[model samples]
Target: MAGCFDVMQHNASFDWDTRRNTYSAIFAGFLFFFAWWLVIDTAVVFTPTGDWNNWYFALAVSCSLSMFMVNSVSNRALEGLYSEEGVLGVKGTRIWLMFGFIGSFACIIAGIWIMFGDYVLQKNDNPKWPGVAIFLHTLLTFIASLTYKFGRSEELWD
Candidate 1:
């Protein structure tokens, strides 16, 4: 069984990082739309709470914060991997990759909140299972993205 698993394993490489970056950017865009859907649903459900415009504002703020975090992380990663000349050439592009991961995380979180809050208030929902599902999905997706370059390599804590 271990041998079978080893046969299918992948390893870290620059090529792998490049592929991951493409996928990351695509997913990030998906997250932006996902957040939009959630906010719209929330406002529609809770129109009595106030005007619908505020929910869009919340979504915008969350995405903006996420982009800031993404840029910060990407900047560090680029600095570590490239020389100053390389960094100058690529830094602007790297920011997009960071934006993807951060945006995905933010959208997933907001989606959970919007979907569950109204469910609980209007449908007498119990959120224990749904909450766990949301958490695990978010965590697993994040870990998967972060480790895409490492492939099958396992990291152990000392």
Candidate 2:
């Protein structure tokens, strides 16, 4: 048992320098899990009896995941921005970065709009848990991406 535990610990160990990456990944995982939970809860537990549309919840999940992917890809591209020898010119890199940021921002805005227009404004007396969950998921995705980006830095913020 001790031997097995030691092996497991060794495999799970992460370098201190990459702790931020681990944390951001964990946060992303939690966000995805919560999003899934929200969807399932809405479907199984809180079956909408009114004229509620399911598209809003779906859109929220899609937007959150899409934002995360775009931000990650753009961040990887931006890493090559300062490289003078790269095939992608600095101008191209900047363009990609700008597009990625815009897409991410758009996703957040869309999530908010869905939450407000679908759940908040509805005339139902049902709990607004789904909308709240989606909004939190979108916000957490944004935060996780920012954490991944800034966590790469080793400098102390003075």
Candidate 3:
């Protein structure tokens, strides 16, 4: 058991100049775990005893997944902005970055829209956990992506 633990620690000890990647990865993992738990808890374990169908679970899952995908794509697209040379040239790189920014904002807006339209409007008297979870997931996804993108900066105040 000690040998196994030593091997695991050795494998995990990689040189990282900054803590952004580690922090972002941790945050993303936590967000995903929380989302999974929330869905399982609400949809399966603690479900209200009825024949009712709660669509919020599906919506929350979809929104969280979409936010993650959008963040990933945007992060990849941002690579072009930092490259010294690209096949598509500087203009194309700028375009890619612009599109990525737009997509990120669009995902955020969509999350807000779903929260307001599905939860706030429908359950005005009693707001539920699903909407809040989706919103928090979206925000976390955005922060994680930004952290990954800007984490490599050599600036004094990063």
Give the number of the best model, judged by lDDT: 2
- Pairs in clash, predicted candidate 1: none
Query: Worst 10-residue stretch by lDDT in candidate 3?
Result: 45-54
Report the C-alpha lDDT of model 3 over 52-104, residue by residue, as the tens digit.
Answer: 23655555555555444444433334454444554656566556556665665
Q: Model 3 compared with the native: what TM-score? A: 0.53
Which stretches of model 2 miss by more than 4 angstroms? 1-18, 47-52, 73-87, 153-158
lDDT of 1 by residue, 42-61 (tens): 44654564423344445445
lDDT of each: 0.49, 0.62, 0.55
TM-scores for all candidates? 0.36, 0.62, 0.53
Cα RMSD for predicted model 1? 10.4
lDDT of the structure predicted as candidate 1: 0.49
Error of 1 at 64 (Å): 4.1
Write the residue-wise lDDT of candidate 2 on 12-40 in tens digits.
66676646566666776676666567656
Clashing residue pairs, backbone N/CA/C < 3 A, model 3: none
**Clash totals for all models, in order?**
0, 0, 0
Name the candidate that leads on TM-score: 2
